[model samples]
Target: MPELPEVEGVVRDLRPIVEGKTIAQVALSETVFTSHDAGKQTIVKNNEPHQFERLIQQMTIIELKRRSKYIFFQLEKDGETFHLINHLGMTGAWFVVNDITEITEDKFRKHIHAVFTLTTGELLVFSDIRRFGELRFIKEIEEHPPLLKMAPEPFDEDACDFFITQSEKPKYRNKPIKEVIMDGQVISGCGNIYATESLFKMNIHPGRKTNRISRERKQQLFQVICDVLQESINSGGSTISDYRSINGGAGTMQHRLKMYGKKQCLTCDTTTKSIVIAGRTSTYCPKCQR
Candidate 1:
């Protein structure tokens, strides 16, 4: 799953290439999922795929923004403006190609579920091997259920306070700090990998109760979260598995991870340990993170 840093990196790489460009054509594989709204029950089916073409063909992309792990495209057609939201599920990736010929030569074509033909003769392709990704067209992004329900981005100034407040609440107070931070409603886009890394950096155990953390320690944890996320973005995000930049390149941050996948602590002689919290594998240094 792509987290804040990976999605942020995608937004940065896509803005320059897709902005100001008109959609010459839109091609979607039948296996690709499409929805008119954010609800799972509102899935488009049967001949509805053609409806996707009808709604999006020739629409111009004005801007691109990332909300949580979702990609938003500000689109225009005639005088009407709408939004396209993409959720890259598990194995999804976007790539730009010079032409359709490049698509055939590319190794990932078999999984290329969606392609946007640009006026510049370039092809923007989205490939998802597992087909868990989604493409949605919504008239108002703010009112869309998914976007509407998301908490503020982790980089938002109020996010730290929000985390602290949420931690003190009964719903989250007794939960493991790792699980608390991983809640998208508490803090968006802080996934398993980054949360583990951040907690390790703050010398906080992943299994610590959220309410057990002191105010000062919470402040440090908040800063560590921001620092780890920003550093991951700077390093192009971790590419532990399926994540890739728009240019089909792997992120370097995985190589720089301190505790997420480590067997031993770099700071101390203590061995690292793994446990499941919120159903995700968490790694931490037993001696360093307490």
Candidate 2:
């Protein structure tokens, strides 16, 4: 899945190219995206794929923003404003190209589901092999169910306080720290990979009970989480699998990983270990972390 850093990288790479540009044309596959709701499966945004193609035409992109792992595009049409929300689930990605002709030559086009042709003759394409991505044309992001439900961004001023408060909650107190941090409602954008790396840096065992952590250590953990996420964003995020920037560039953060997928500890000579926490594989240094 494309986590915070990866989504941040995509947002950074896209702002310059897409902002202020008018949508000249829109093309969408029959079933571009899918979602699950109360035991029922449906297309994203409760609209047919073609509806997205119609809603975005002639609209100018005002700004691009990210909340949690979701990307938002502020749009203006005839002086009216709206928003487009996108979630790059699993293998989803956005690719920028000079012309639509080049899309066929790019490997990402094999799964191309949506294409936005800009007035400048450039193209912004959304490709998702698994069809798990999300696309919604929303009038207000603040009221949207998904965006409204997300916790504060890691960079928010009250992030540490939020994490501590959420940790002390009865529902989370006995949960493993790794699982606690990975919960999007507690702290948005800390996925499995970043969660493992941050815990390793904080020298906190991934399996430690959330309530067992001291207030000082909680603050330290929060700081390390910010550090890990910012560093990954600086390195363009980890490309352990299909993640890539808008320019089709692979992220370099994967090479800088200390414990996420390593067999040896970066701080000591002891061998690393792996365990499943909250159904995700977590790798850490036994000696260094705890």
Residue-level lDDT tens digits of model 2 in 1-290: 88999999999989988999999888876554443324344325655556768888999999998889989999999999998889898878888888655655355677788888899888888887776787788787665776676789999998889999988999999999999999998999999889988898888999999888998999899889999999999999999676667756778999998888888898997998888999998888888887
The per-residue C-alpha lDDT of model 2 at residue 287 equals 88
Worst 10 residues of 1 by lDDT: 38-47
What's each prediction's TM-score? 0.91, 0.91
- Over 4 Å off, model 2: 31-43, 101-107
Residue 166's lDDT within candidate 2 is 88
Instruction: Give the per-residue lDDT of model 1 (tens digit) for 1-290.
Output: 88999999999998999999999998886554443333342222223666877888899999999988888899999989998888888777888898655644254677787788899989898887666777788788655665676778888888888888888899999999999888988888889889998998888999999888998898888889889999999999988676677857778999999888889998996888999998898998888888
lDDT of 1 at 203: 89
Judged by lDDT, which candidate is best? 2
Clashing pairs in 1: none
For candidate 2, the TM-score is 0.91
